[model samples]
Target: MKTILITGASSGLGKAIGEYLFHKGYNVFGTSRHPEKVLNSPFPLLALDLNQPETIGRCVGKVIEIAGRIDVLVNNAGVGIMGPLEEIPGDEIRKHFETNLFGPVEVMKAVIPHMRRQGAGHIVNITSIAGYTGLPFRAAYSASKGALELLSEAIRMEVRPFGIKVCNLAPGEFATDIASRRYYTELSPASAYAEVYGRTLELINQQVSGGDDPVMVAYEIEKIINTPDPKIHYKVGPFLSKFSIVLKRILPDKTYEKMLMKHYRL
Candidate 1:
């Protein structure tokens, strides 16, 4: 059986992926900052906090000790932040990147060496469709996921000769508890962005709540793992959400920007 490790498996998309793969009979180990708190998990949860670098190595080590060799590493743990770029605190931005970007990078570092020794492995980084464009209120999220996409491209090539594969799975909005965890800058009446930003925020939350089921993502991940030669990027979501990436590519720069502005009624 192929051993798989997924970060941030406590809830949301990560939990869904872990559950799907576990039932599919893969030897899956998931990471949560507090494993004991995640009760009734089908597979065991390892303690790993993305914000704590020390926990990363230990978590990977525990997986290796238990499973002997990890066939796949899924970097699915991340956080969300939203607000007018100017108003979002610098510290919060840094903290966001720490979880969404640097955390995954470090996890990759921890797992790669063992995969190299085994002479085979795959790493799937869960990115976002928002990464493809600069969304008005999700500037930091866009940058972080975009950076991970590019980083995956670079690492995929670097690890190819070692028999390890790297790819990005960018999902659009899904019905998850992400909105509850997202950090939102205060919407004060005196603030210039209060009216439009508040409206956009509500729309964003609604979109997430009404979005496609995350099981689709779990199925997609399973497909990627089973394919002999997986592509560098895989996008899963609603038709319009997936098509938005294409629209950005073909449409004029300002035209796309205008469309987005109109979508948010900004």
Candidate 2:
């Protein structure tokens, strides 16, 4: 059985993917911030905190020790930050990048040597549609994902000769517990963008609550893993959401900005 290691498998899309693959007969190893809390997890769980980059190598080593060899890695662990760029503190922004970008990159760095030695492997970085366009108040989150997408593109070429594949799985909104997990910047009562931020926050919550099932993303991931050669970018979401990428490519700059503003009622 092919061995797969997935990050953030305690819940959300990560959990769904782990469970899906386990049922399909793959030897699945999953990571969670609190592995013990995931009582009913079908696969082996490793404790991992993306904020602590130093622990990444140890966790990957543990997987290699048990699974013998990791055939695939799914960097699905991530956190969200929401607020106006100005109001969000520098430390919080750093934290966002640390978890979303640095953590995954470090994991890749740790696993790449093993993959290279084996002469074959696949790495899937779970990015977001927010990467394509900056959201009204989610500037940091957008920037982090955007950077990850670019990193994936560059790394894909670098590792192709080694028989290792890398791709960005950018998903649109999904009905996950993201809202609860997100860190909202503490807004001051006198802040200039307070009212608009409040409105935007409400809108974001509503959208997330009504988003598509995360299982859809899991199914798409399965397809990518099964394909002998997958594209560098695999977008998964509703029709309009996926089409937004094409729109961004064709639409004029100001027009795209206007559409985003109108969508958020800015």
TM-scores for the candidates: 0.99, 0.98
Error of 1 at 66 (Å): 0.6
Query: Which window of 10 residues has the lowest lDDT sum in candidate 1?
Result: 181-190
Off by over 4 Å in 2: none
Candidate 2 C-alpha lDDT tens digits along 1-266: 78999999989899999999999899999999888878999899998888787678789999888877989999999999999998899999998999999999999998999999999999999999989988899999999999999999999999999999999999998898999999999889899989989999999898888999998888888888888899999898878888888999999999998998998888
What do the candidate models score in CA lDDT, each in turn?
Answer: 0.95, 0.91
Off by over 4 Å in 1: none
User: Residue 212 CA error for candidate 1 (Å)?
Assistant: 0.8
Q: For residue 50, what is the lDDT in candidate 2?
A: 84
lDDT score for residue 159 of model 1 = 97
Candidate 1 per-residue C-alpha lDDT over 1-266 given as tens digits, one digit per residue, 9 for 90 to 100: 78999999989999999999999999999999999887889999999999999999999999988889999999999999999999999999999999999999999999999999999999999999999999999999999999999999999999999999999999998999999988888867999999999899989999999999999999999999988899999999999999999999999999999999999999
Model number with the top TM-score: 1
Considering summed lDDT, which 10 consecutive residues are worst modelled in model 2? Answer: 48-57
